[model samples]
Target: MVRTQDLTYSYDARHILQFPDMHCAAGEHWLLLGQSGSGKTTLLHLLGGLLSPHGGFVEVASTRLNNLSASELDHFRGQHIGIIFQQPHFVQSLTVEENLLLAHQLAGFRPERRRAHELLAHLHIGHKSNVRPNRLSQGEQQRLAIARAIINRPKLVLADEPTSALDDHNCEEVLALLEREAGQVGATLLIVTHDGRLKDRFHHRIFLQSTQA
Candidate 1:
């Protein structure tokens, strides 16, 4: 579901980052391991179509991201890619359920109220459906973020530093939830993290070296 070749990105002429080729099949769960400056998150962004690569190409679910126009990329990402950032960002004014409903709408699908509730319930936050996001605890908020990302049943799921801030128990819980939910939707799961706690959890792994040249 995800592939990249000779992918490169640069913030300036002095700092160029090059990534190794990668391939992760549909429904597979993989871990992207790297140190702080290894460009793991950058590669994830390129794959998700949030950033255009300086060289080479990113393909997800058979679509070559480099060939898409900005609007087309946005639409494609909304419909096929789901991302969970290190920090969750939400529409603070909107209720939890509304935030998820908006995800479906943005993906060009009718908002399915039942699905939203079901997802929230699975995440153990169904009671917060009518509450504003800002009112939830950090753990609850993260669960909500997970629900929002998969609400559209994306073909690929990208998570960046998802367990860095959690305790051991919570870390395990979050990882299990991620794997379970992604499997339920048959989505390829790629987690970009520097956390050592995850090294043994995934059978498929990609290790990146720092390329800050």
Candidate 2:
């Protein structure tokens, strides 16, 4: 569902990252391991269409990101790629449910209350649906980010440092939640993290260092 070809990214003419080639099949779950400044997050942004490549092609679900206009790319991103950013970014003014609902509403998809409730319930936070994100615990908010990421039922789920802040139990919780969400919708799960321990949990490992140009 996600692939890149000879991707080279840079900032201020300094090459920050490069991918000779990469690919992941639909429903594949991959753990991306790299050191700090190893381009893990940059690669995730490229996969999720948040960053345009300075070179080579990137395709998500057969749609070439380089070919799309800004508006079209935004629409494509919303409709197909779900991203779990390193931080849990939520609008403080909106309730937890509202924050998630807004994500779907932006994509021209009516929020499926049943699915949202189910997701929240599965994550053990259904009762807090009406509360603002700030009122929730750190764990609750992290789970909420997972909820929001999968709310649109995207074809590809890109996670960045998802397990960084979690305990052993919460790490398992988050990973399982992502597994279930990706499995339920047949989306590919591509997680980017510096930790090597994640390799044990996932069957497929994409060690980014190996793909460096």
Candidate 3:
């Protein structure tokens, strides 16, 4: 679950971003819609504990992110939050399976190769398990990213512009995968995107408006 109150951030005295109070219950799916400069990515980072808010709080899975130290936040995020960025980032030097195992190791859990392979199989990229990430096609890479995100069965899944680069068919496919996979683990799913095409896909949504609008 997630809850935010009076969340505000600014780079300087002249500019500020204010976010609406929002809440998502356990296992709920939400779309965070906004235009560019509406603080969608900023808010996502705050929610993921990647950025410290200049004001207010971001709570996830009942933990107040503002209260955590940098190291603690990193650990907590690894264990509880799964983030899918607009561009998938991976350890190119490592094979797909190795990269997933790294996630488990970073989260302080014992590596489970069987679980990792099962996720890759579920994502339809089982054959790419031993291949380096760079060799995969775009769609395969995307699916691999999904596999990595949910591999830990995180409590909260946050995706940033997940469908931005896909065609309609791929867009729908990715969204369905995200929803179904997250739901399987009873995780709360929140996607932050400016894509209008996603507006009708999710029943719960929050709009981040540009302060200058």
Best by lDDT: 1
Query: Model 3: per-residue lDDT, tens digit, 1-213?
Result: 899998989978778899999889999999999989898999999999999998899999899999999999999999999999998889989999999999999988899999998889998989989999999887778888887888888999999999898888888889999999999989999999998888998899998789741
Whole-model alpha-carbon lDDT for candidate 2: 0.85
The C-alpha TM-scores of every prediction are 0.98, 0.95, 0.97
Error of 2 at 200 (Å): 0.6
In angstroms, the error of model 3 at 12 is: 2.1
User: Of 1 and 3, which scores higher on TM-score?
Assistant: 1
Q: What would the per-residue lDDT of candidate 2 be over residues 103-208, giving only the tens digit for each residue? A: 8888779878788888889889999999999999878888999888888889999999998888888888888888988898889999999865577888888776
User: Higher-lDDT candidate among 1 and 3?
Assistant: 1
By TM-score, the best candidate is 1
In TM-score terms, candidate 2 sits at: 0.95
TM-score rank order = 1, 3, 2
lDDT of 3: 0.91
After TM-score superposition, the amount by which residue 73's alpha carbon in candidate 3 deviates from its true location, in angstroms, is 0.5
Worst 10 residues of 3 by lDDT: 204-213
Per-model CA lDDT versus the true structure: 0.93, 0.85, 0.91
